[model samples]
Target chain A: MPFKDFSKGLVKANPLFVLVLGLCPALAVSTSIENAFGMGLAVIFVLVLSNLIISLLRNMIPKDVRIPCFIVIIATLVTIINITFKAYLPSLTESLGVYLPLITVNCIILGRAEAFASKNPPLRSVLDGVGEGIGFLLAMLLISFIRELLGSGGLNFTILGYKLGEFTIPVFSSMPALFFIMPTGAFLIIGLLLGLFKKTGVLR
Target chain B: MKENVKRVVVLTIIILVSSLSLYAYYTSTEDLIREQETAKLTEEINQIFPDAGRFVQKEDIYYVYSDDGDLIGYAFKATGKGYGGDISILVGVNNDEDLTIRKISVLSQSETPGLGTRITEDEFISQFNNKPIDAIKLRSNNGEIDAITGATISSNAVVNAVYTEYKNKIKSIQR
Candidate 1:
């Protein structure tokens, strides 16, 4: 009835808003839409692959040592992605830095493995991973969009090598709010967005 | 009894397979990974010296040479303790005593995001481009570079790094 487990990570058990896991990179890199998108994709890659691998080998992992095993698997996957990104997407990799490696403990990876993968069929677990990943990506991208536009007074980027025109708000451009790009800015944006979501029934 | 033994063997086989797969991936990709890293440095060097046809390395310094084999300038990396972590900057000096700054990239830093990271922004690094070697300091300190508001630690880190490196490198070149 619940589509096994894939449907749960969307909203009822969202990783960022609902579960409140992996707040470090969420706050650290969410200043701009581009940074948030890259970070989200990196997290997705780590989560989905780790879940699939763990689910496939769930039977072999002993219960007592399962946590350690999951960590190793997640860490190795993260390293591979990190290396590949460095080779191919040097700019994004440089922007990511330690946050890439820190994905091993992002809670979303291990949380999915333990909460959903272990209990569900391998295919369902994979879908669940995808759902949660998309959810996180969407949430991060939205928050960063507002932050970058407001804080920097402009959004200039070339996504996948295609240029998006420089976005600038005239008022903010002339006098950009310094706080929107700060650590506290991330908190303020996310908190207000969360409140807005609740008030508008977007989260309920 | 036979079924139980078979189950044990299967589990062991899965463990071995997974570990071997990862190990194979790591081993095969290691060389390619190293090459990628070298390519990155080479690319950065090219950006710093658009006219530099090639370069040579002596010790840790890179000597950029033009197509005609003339010495264009000397570029070297400097690491300074920043608010968050090590701030690595590429310093290039021409024969005329003018500095190109080449680039001032943050290799790693933990300073407050937005505020501190802004130090790497072009507006900040642009201040160093073509700057005379002696004029590297915070505008507040009677130099030309403007400090990022509320990010004095990060701002000062870049300023100090350039100042200290300029002084030391000048002395070394003179000797």
Candidate 2:
């Protein structure tokens, strides 16, 4: 399989940097690292599974019915994840809430399955899914790391009873700038990050 | 003709296999999923009433009991229409029907993050913990509770939701 298809998504066709898909979740959930990680994994699951299923059925789906077929398949997978999360990982599910179901229209997953997976071999398609998923994850985590540290003044989190130490630096902790955690702050962060990526030739 | 038929058969087989695999995976995990949701509610209750040894749920309201099985409190969810969207909070009331406020966890909210969302902060939520039920109205309405600045609607939404649900839920438990 040509590795170019996979590598392209990392930079040249990067989901956030270049393709600019799934921006809503990127902006909304990047307030905290924990949320970003949860959203990233959820994206990975949806992207990979949707790609696999679309690739497997690419030939059989009629041209007229393809879009509807893809929608049904993607919606089904999203609902399953939504219900499963509601039942099992309730805290993450609670935090994520409607964003879980919003995965159906995330654009990245559907755009990939339709444009790449439907035309490629299953193995190549899977690799594309993984590459794009990782790219999305990388972008979100980077944004979240900055947001959490600056907005909340700490990196404190505990998952499944595991203690993550409070990483509060002296000055930032006491009077953490509240603006960094607001909606407008997210827009500013993404805009600045986009410019930084372009200026540094990270997105050229 | 034979080649076309072969391709059709192969595609059908693949679709069948994929569908079956997903169905199996979903069914097997369904039970675990329900348990996790129940455990989450229990954990939330325990946070509010740490000594809650048992509880009963009816119509989405939870009645928490102590280790001695005495009624400690009653809890129910309150949902309000806020400026951004629906704001849902879990409301807990003690044996006196006064709020014990196990914890006011935001179930869903779309208020402006820093300004309105601070309603979920302990400084705000803890105020409701042991307060009298009748005094739950927002301070703007001449009640005791203070509204978060720039978030009167958000704050009021929570206050109103809690008050409305309390009035309703407290009646059933009193009976």
Candidate 3:
């Protein structure tokens, strides 16, 4: 039962595709695999912790003021993540910019707090958070892989600002499709993916 | 009436706890964050002035010194509104009479890839080197700089920023 709660979010309740929540960061930061990974990690950190805290305090939080309380908790966690990133990962901090702070209002975090965390026990809520967070991460990676590969004609891997390895495709590197890196590309790719998922019944 | 009191108390407690923890975390990481920024600035300065020894900051300008402690040139940041976002350039100027540009390195930019981003290439940046401050404008403006073929806006942004910022900061360096 506990495992079911965790695995459900991986595909069935996938936050980006299934539930279709939190597309702002998805579209904005999915330009590069590195940026997508960074944003995904940050989201997971906030989601898991916020879920745990909200679930533990569900009883103490009154129904009338629960939304405000959840916002406060989520905002606090986001700020902490921002400070940590600025200190240790300054490059990522610069890249993420306003989108990092905007995570406080990301419907996924708040939605989970209101829907799953506030109603379930702490353990179950945490599992839901992890499952949903990973689902978001996987979706982001998939989108970025396509965008960065087609847009930039290459892929570069970095962990904590350290370059792991990178390679460029032969033909694509010389004459890559520049459109794939733009905002228009993001919208088009996401829309097509959404359609594909629905057609294949992954979303249904 | 009693339920209202409970709501107020719980909300108040939550806010208080959140603020306290956030404050604690911020204080702990404040020094580390500041250190990273300063280190980054120093590295950028060194890149612009490879042989630079010590740098002194007065206002927004940095006075670069040689290994023997003699003043070599001036270095400062120029910010311009680019196509995507603000473009920041670190400019190095020789201490000559005309204050000719020694070198320039882009600190940060968010311009379009492959086009606007070509501003960072040596082909564009090299044009600024050893040129007089007055010649910072594009050739279209009767100046020495050449605008990137497809990235006029991004190129113009860097040229204009360097010209404007140099004019603004020259007086302080001259003093």
Candidate 4:
């Protein structure tokens, strides 16, 4: 049963593709795989924790003021992650910039809090958060892989500010399509992916 | 009325708990954040003035000195309002009478990814090196620097900021 809760987030109700939530960070930070990964990790951390807390406090939180109570919890979690990143991963913090703090307002975290966590038990809610978070992460990686490869003509991988490896395609590296890194590219890619997902019956 | 009281009490407790946790975390990490910032500044200063052994900070300026304790040059941060946000630059000045620019390193920026952000690239920043501070305008403005092709505003922001801040800091240095 817990596995079902987690697995549903991975495909059945994928946050970015199916639920269509948290498109802001998905579009803005998907310019690079590294950035996308960093954003995904942060979201996962916030989502899972927020879900657990909100679930545990579901009964204690009054219905009339649950939204504000959830927000306070989510915002607190976001701040904690932001500070942690700033201290230990300064480079990622620099790259993530305002988007890191903006996680407080991300729809996925709040959406899960209000829709799933508020009513579910703590264990189930946590699984849901993990599933949804990973779904978002995978979606971000897919979009960014396309953008960085076609837009920048290469893929430069880094983890925690450490250079892992990098490779550039010959012709693409010389004169890549610059638009792929722009906001237009983000919209184009996501729109096409959404269409493709529908055509292949991934969305249903 | 009784239900309303419960709602208020619940919300207050949640907020109070959140605030206290945030307070604890921020206070604990404040020193580490400050240290990172200082380390970054030191690294940028060293890059701009590689010969310098030490630096003294007065207001927003750094007085850089060589290993022999001779005044090497002066370095200061200049901020320009770019297309996306404030662009920060560390401008180094030669100790000569003209106060020619030694080098400039973009410390941080939030400009457009591929266009306006080119301000941080060597091709754009290297143009500032060894030029008279007074001549830090774009070619169209009859000055030395050339603006980035598609990023005139961002390029101009850097040039204008460096020029204006240089004028201000030079006055203090002369005093």
Q: State each model's CA lDDT, in order.
A: 0.76, 0.80, 0.92, 0.92
Quick one: best TM-score, which candidate?
3
> Per-residue lDDT of B75-159 in model 3, one digit per residue for the tens?
9999999999999999999988789999999988999887899999999999999999888899999999999988999999999
lDDT of 4 by residue, B11-104 (tens): 9988998899889999999999999988888888899988889898998889998999999899998999999889999999999978899999
Residue pairs with backbone overlap in model 1 = B84-B110
Worst-scoring 10-residue span by lDDT in model 3 chain B: B166-175
Query: iRMS of each prediction in angstroms?
Result: 4.6, 5.3, 0.9, 1.3
Question: Order the candidates by TM-score, highest first — what do you get?
Answer: 3, 4, 2, 1
What CAPRI-style quality would you assign to candidate 4?
medium
Here the TM-score of candidate 3's chain B is 0.94
Candidate 4 has an lDDT of: 0.92
User: For each of the candidates, what fraction of the native contacts does it recover?
Assistant: 0.12, 0.24, 0.90, 0.86
Q: Which pairs of residues clash in candidate 2, taking residues 3 or more apart in a chain or in different chains?
A: B48-B102
**lDDT of model number 3:** 0.92
Q: Give the TM-score of candidate 2.
A: 0.83
Q: Model 2 residue A98 lDDT? A: 77
Give the per-residue lDDT of model 1 (tens digit) for B37-130. 7787777777777888887777667788899998877777777777777888877766454544555554456565556778878888788777
How close to the true structure is residue B148 of candidate 3, measured as C-alpha lDDT?
A: 91
> Candidate 3 vs candidate 4: which has greater DockQ?
3
Error of 2 at A192 (Å): 2.8
Model 4: residues >4 Å from true position, as ranges?
none
